[model samples]
Target: MDAVGLSLMNEAVGGSEKCVSAVREAFGAAEALMIRNVSQVAKDFRCCQTPKDHQDQVELMQSLADIVMGTVQYNEESVLMSISDLCGVMTNQSAAYNEEREPYQRLVKLSQIYRSSSEEPCLDVSHEKRVKDLMDTTVQSERRAERQWTYQTCTEFGFYQTCEDASCPFSGMVTLRSQTEICLELFGISQNSLPGRVAFTNRYYGGDEPHAHRVLYVNGGVDPWKELSVGNRTDGGEEAESVFIRDSAHCADMSRGRVTDRRSLKNARQEIEKHVESWLKTAQQEKKRTE
Candidate 1:
């Protein structure tokens, strides 16, 4: 009886091993079949069947089977539902690729509509109107003029301030030339005597004037009295006010020898012109000296 019982136990063990091996072989075959189906579908859709693509699809299908077979657990019903959803997505993507001609035409039409709509309004506006709109905002004018100035000046300039007070003009130009010059000197540009640079003009005017304010001519460009503020809090919590302070100092020093000693709007125009000419002359002399 003991020997018979031992033989029966051995038979049961062998049967279990065979079942496990069969299941593994079946899983591998099912995975391969899924890959083959996906490849055929991709080929029909004229998409490239790359090795990576095949591997991805095989893995996906195997994961799906594992969930279905309860080899991977968490909600078996949810896994089954997800497999159906994946099939729907694949079908839609396949359809989109297969009917390529109509979709391509629609895309081309949409792009044409976008291009036409974007360009037509811009072209419809008159040149004068466009210029007026561009200049209407003080910030816009400042931004457009900024690149013409040096990087330091660009950083120093600020937006225009509007005044509704009848005593004041619609716009007021604030001079920051003194600030800029001081900073330039500190940077070692004007070591000996401050180089003669153009003074910026500040103007306040109201009413119907074509040129509401006079912009000073400097280096073949206009210089308006605009204060540019710069500096930021450093990591060490120290404020580097040297940049603005130096610029203001330079401006004050240069203002001393000017024909008009005042900082008024009228003096600003004359002084700026004189300073500009001085700067040009100095530049030419330096060039000749170097040559």
Candidate 2:
């Protein structure tokens, strides 16, 4: 998700080092504000004592923090656009993109409000109302797919993008505990069971060192998820290949070839095509041998 933000930031700034630093500072400020709001909300929730059980209060905090972390993903278009608008303003390119854009205007208004008050603006989300709204909404097919994916994460793959690492660009509020608590809440999968489950999955599938043939492991340099993907295998026994596109973001090679694409990305796509062609030819040869 941070990769999405970084890619979008680079696009918006267009190589302006000044705008890059300014946009990073702006993102840090936004993260700080969100952390402050979540902290205040947690304190208020604990003190309110609205007949909720201790367990329920803890679950609510986890859920709320999960919501806050969701804004950091690419699914939240508004957050991405806000950052893009901030970048545009810093680079003096907002008018070039859209003269009628409202994001910059809204950002300006928000800045004005922040300047006028001694207290920082807080985003106060009503927990009860939020829960009610979610309950009242109808679940769609896309949401069903999401539920299935979430279950896989809880059961087999603990692929949670947490901010526990010091190098993570996001705030520390997005912890592994906050993510694991969701599994407990939804599927009765405790945090304690996650390690064993993930280990079993790795053992079953040979996680990083899979014994395979004609497999191409392609990854983008800027993509955070690439850390989990198979890179260069030292054994060099399998008919597998790895291509590292240093200038690309997530799934960049999956897109249609563009004239503006970096040379590394273009070469990577060609390499993937070569792998596919070789696999098809190998399959044809095996069919002839069987016949």
Model 2 clashing residue pairs (backbone): none
> RMSD for each model, in Å, please?
33.8, 8.3
The ten-residue window of minimal lDDT in model 1 covers 217-226
TM-score of 2: 0.64
lDDT of 1 by residue, 115-174 (tens): 343433211112223234434435556334533343333232223222223222111111
Model 2: residues with Cα > 4 Å off, grouped in runs? 1-142, 234-238
* lDDT accuracy of residue 251 in candidate 1: 36
Question: Which prediction has the highest TM-score against the true structure?
Answer: 2
Model 1, TM vs. native: 0.16
Ten-residue region with minimum lDDT total, candidate 2: 70-79
lDDT of 2 by residue, 1-291 (tens): 344335444542232344445434443544444345645434433323231333333344333333323322322132233333434454564455354233323333334433344242433234443233433325754345556677799899888866565444444555788667667756777999999999999998898987676788887665556778999753554368788976565677887787877788888988888878978998999999999
Highest-lDDT candidate: 2
